[model samples]
Target: MQISYLQQWLTTPTYKIHRSQLRFWFSLSLTFSVIYSVLALELAFRGNYLIDSDARQHVFWMQRFLDPALFPNDLITDYHQSVAPSGYAALYWLIAQLGIPPLILNKLLPTLLGVITTSYCFATCLQLLPVPAAGFIASLVLNQTLWMRYDLVSGTPRAFIYPLFLAFLYYLLRRSLLPCLIALALQGLFYPQCVFISSGILVLQLWRWHKGRLCLSGNKQDYLFCVAGLGTAFLVMLPYALQSSEFGAVITAAQAKISPEFLPGGRTPFFHDNFLEFWFYGKRSSLVPRLSRITPLIYTGLFLPFLLWKSSQFPLARQVTPKVQVLIQGIIASLGMFVIAHVLLFQLHHPSRYTMHSLLVLLALAAGITLTVSLQALFNWAKCSPKSYPWKGYLARGTTVFLAIVLIIYPVFTPFPYAKYKQGKEPLLYEFFSQQPKHIMIASLSEEANNIPSFAQRSVLTSEMYTIPYHVEYYNQIRQRTIDLIRAQYSADLTLARNVIETYGADFWLLDRTAFTPEYIRGSNWLMQFSEARAVVTELEQGIIPALSGIMEQCSVLETEYLVVLPTDCILKFAQRKRN
Candidate 1:
């Protein structure tokens, strides 16, 4: 019996032999992977390390490796504290054992994992499209979407998980159940967020099975696989889960001490009037403006038309079978996860960061359509006979070439300065801290100030203490109560300031010249008095300072230069008199 073309394509021994094509796919994968790794390493070593309030917890964990027992029961306890993800921590620990300093390992390990993840992402893309070019194209598109900007520079665990999750999905699509289960289980160990994504994929897989698209031997095996995958993942995660439990005590204590209103609302308006200002005027800002915001109606304008045009060009583009339909449904479901999180849970101030996965899905669909249409157009133009036309053959080749160039070369050469841009105020602070060797404690209004401890070999605190409160809340609660007692006894005069400073054992007050301006301080009776006495040692200046004049009047100058505030003679004399 003559085999149908689809059957021949699926069952042929030549198609099954991946090794024959492995060389090209591997080469393309490595090229882009190396570029991301290099970028990550550069950021880790050369760039200053700090990631808002949430990431400060990770830095705390890395610090604990100096004395494992320092973290009670081997748990990470920091602000927004949770059990540390074992995969990255374990890797960092091992590198630390090899005598690589935390500063270097922080960059090196994430870079290595990113490269591994990118390589696997390439492999997975190749399996789905089976065009040598598809692997290159998909990898390139993913690379171009600023994957390195976050993972390489910021060293986020989410970056490490993305490629791994993509690889697992690729294996799942190919019906490699065992490998898929293993990948899923491993992902659970590294990033628990993977569980939500894995659950979505399992639903899709079960739908495929129910529709008779997946020819499993029995329902029992399927059930066993699902249970085993989830069970194994949980087992691997047990240690970290237990470690995170202590954090509840910390949060509860912190909440009791501080006002609930003090926490920043995670939700904000999705659309703001000042949206065009960032896109058109402030092009050089560190915060990456959301694509949705930059072109408010573009999602509808471009996406709908392009999707329609691409679907028409490719006959198979319309999802037909139960399996293909399930896959499409899975992508939609993943995007829905992002949408719901942004709309309800996350503060609207950072919709762009949370919507990264959704953006990736959109770009992936765009890439797939672009390649399919471009190849089809080429095949028609060539007008070769059926045997020579090789529809699949041309697609595989063209996609590979396009991807190799776009993903690998474009990021390295692009003048975006993503690493520098994302570094924000932390790098500038690191430079200043490195120049000073004071053991004095420095307090600031900015979270970036916390990074000074790492650079200056001094103790530093920030308003982040009150905001995140994490594991430190337990300690801070005691400190706050002590401060309150000192304040009530002394009243709101200079006497209260002196008593609080002595009680807190603080030597230096490092104000954020950008955030704690004259206008903002005017509203606070305490800050107004505190600024009057503190002598300006340095004035930390940035370009944004001039534009924030409305907020500046609240602050009084302790320092004239606007570089950094160290206690000057006049300030020290005022503080001494208050103490007396």
Candidate 2:
């Protein structure tokens, strides 16, 4: 009766099922979507207080999305739009029509992307293995990684593109070319790097298929599908290509600015680093050595051995088929990409943000191989005259369940004290900003400036400065004028201090204590070393130091030394002192 009821319900137009056996899949997908949506809403409501720099930028842009006309005519030209991919901006612009706050949209969109991507993974696995357990396990495994959670919470543009790229791959595997092409083109808009890597894999797959080396069961439709998809992707990229003169210049500049020495490392080869670090290491840490940045290669190494073992388990005929060959080729191509990336690009101090797509692909391949081999090994152990091993069945089942939990729940819950502010400082920052006047000109380190608006509710100029130094080369050619303006405006502390008093006429300065440390302020020496610095610091500095006792005489501390204000003339005097 239950089965009949389920069948009847699935037959209903609102819950239509094209495949009789897929009734449960529809229910499962709907359930997952609901759960993911709820979690996303919770995260958004909780707010990303920990790493609010990127989040705040998204919010600010989302605000621009809400009121497009509010942005200056040179807004796009100012940042050299190439610094960040344009997809998120475009999406925010579209979503703004719905009147949702930037924060809400940021959380909601990524959550939806996550759910859709997970569902697509399940669907793709079903086609390959045609087993419910395999589909479920695949979905669970892919979701278990720290990578997904990091992307989900960071609110970065790559987070939005990652899932879409995966979904496109799934569609391609199923011989759905038109949809694949559409997805491919759209992904280009979000993150071209992802598209580049994904397309490389796809092209390799197709080449294997063409040479009769891959044994796919599909006919002409599959070939047409792939061609159409690739064609569509090209077409979609055409507009951007025409605009490429500007884009190309930016890319060249950014590449030039990246130091060839620092490699951003995280969990690699699966277990070298914990699952948590692999996915959510946040910013590059000094504690994590340069060699550690290449940890992702560890996953690649593990995958190769596992793939060899898995291939040995299959008969030669099965392994030789086009489909299997294509899969093998894909694995190899992905690894090759990773190796090249590690040897060349990874050492450039590029943030995980830049490597996320590659990371996702590499993880997917590694996890897929690991799950396949581990499951096979467990099954063999369970069946091998298990009378010798009393708890073999239980052990196998338990192991499977444990892995499932790791893949599914770990991402959902691991790194305990999830969503809390870093060291509980975010709330203090938030409270401080909440009390500030509007449209204040804040001169501080890039991270603090980017973070203040989200935490405190005040507007800031040049909060994106941190990205600026890295993207200086690109900005020089594409956004030269704006770059010049920012440089001229904030080149010195005196200039910034004076500008704060004159231009925006700001009454307060909210400075992060860490930002004042020599290491943080080293590059902006003019702001730190001027003779009038004592006076500016006196007004802005909250507490007293024995060495700088008279400094506080000229100014009174505000709410805390973390925040202070000075007379407009005093700030101007500081600027003139430096000039003389």
Candidate 3:
């Protein structure tokens, strides 16, 4: 009797809620979303010096909104600012007028985005399965998947993709033309890659498999909606396609194939020796990432089709509306674009981008429906157990209790806020640079260069983080600067160091404590990209000291536990004194 009652209590929320009480489910879904956002915020503001890792590259240049003089003539800043989506940049620019620094805004955006994403996710789930519990389950699973990755917390253009894409799905499912067109336009402005996915979905909706035959939809409305949506997508994306960047053309797949930047262990590695990894799990190449592996409950989505097949066995499965076909259309659309992206390669951006975001939404819906159906089925089985096989009844009751408990408590054990917050460890170094003139440029081969532009609000000649090789002209200049910096750092002749400092107009040099050693050169993957690193390592191994190494004590303006900063003027003076 106690077991039967327990099963009723466990399944009541999903089974008892008819279509009218959906607000109850919506409120519950939103409550959990707020709770998840609260947890992420706690970690986001954990330190005064912390910034999201990707935001270091994407958000740092936005500091110019507050002070136009910052990062003057900086190669790294200009390139990053140029590549930023116009809508994203304009949003930050508008907000900067209200005096909130972009970094602060970046941290706050994730919480707002999470709530918006959750709201859309819940509504989209309800379209497919009206059960309130299913909506809650889907939103809950998506929040877990989102917080597990850096995308949401980064607050870059990619972060907007989730809510905008989910909004597109919800509107598309509702067959609302104007709102859907608006969603399509917003996606193109913020994250253009999704417009292709949205366009693909719009195109795929015109055809249907009816009675085992693939046929075009006879409804004229379908064709009209497709044309309108496609037209919106094209207009929004045309500017990006037709507008030529001064940085030159995007790298071709042929060029990328031979470039070190695309090789294993390189900055943006896409190709891999392992076939399975390259095709199935590589971050840049995979169709679907193993997100379900991390949040195991998502694996339940795989059972959705099976449950629908045996709809007679699960009462709630019958409530699943024909709109569930939208999810199927979404997956098919994603797959279609994924194939086209692979064929076009870099022209479409990463192929994985086409599929991964949409798959997250599709999987969440499927998982929610599947969980609700299974819960209802288990409850029914448990009720019959006492009248029939006693052992079978106990098993059903046990499994029901277990699943409910795991769902409620699983997030407690999973790590929170995988935002990859890069904390500025050397406060004194940042302070020293921050005090310098805005026109000053720092040259460095140290990883610390990646942090300087963000933390100190100063320009760097180049950084590994800023070395995106897409635009050939921009990358050539960046590559040459990197090679020159490497050669100067490890050369025995002071004249070479003097020439590099003058050519780049470098005002300061940042260095790792171990930068002069052969092991440092050999171990640095960024440094190894340049052939100059090998020659430097060879010289260091032969016990030859670099000119900069001999002058560190004389030229250094600031010192940290792991780094040294040298004033360029002091180094130049030393080189002149030696020349005399």
User: lDDT tens string, model 1, 68-89?
Assistant: 4332322113432244566767
User: Which regions of candidate 1 deviate over 4 angstroms?
Assistant: 1-22, 39-57, 67-77, 80-83, 174-179, 209-221, 233-289, 292-326, 335-355, 358-370, 384-417, 420-440, 446-448, 464-466, 469-493, 511-580
Alpha-carbon TM-score of each model against the true structure:
0.64, 0.66, 0.95
lDDT of each: 0.46, 0.47, 0.85
| Root-mean-square deviation of every model | 9.5, 8.6, 2.2
Task: Choose the strongest candidate by lDDT.
Answer: 3
Model 2, residue 92: C-alpha shift (Å)? 1.3
At residue 417, candidate 1 shows an lDDT of: 22
Ranking by lDDT: 3, 2, 1
Candidate 3 Cα RMSD after full superposition onto the native fold (Å) = 2.2
Quick one: best TM-score, which candidate?
3
Where model 2 places Cα greater than 4 Å from the true spot, the runs are 1-43, 47-52, 68-84, 146-149, 209-226, 244-248, 251-326, 332-413, 416-440, 445-447, 453-465, 473-558, 567-570, 573-580
For model 2, how does the per-residue alpha-carbon lDDT over 421-442 read when each residue is reduced to its tens digit?
2222456555755565444444
- Worst ten-residue run, lDDT, model 1? 533-542
Q: Candidate 3 — worst ten consecutive residues by lDDT sum?
A: 6-15
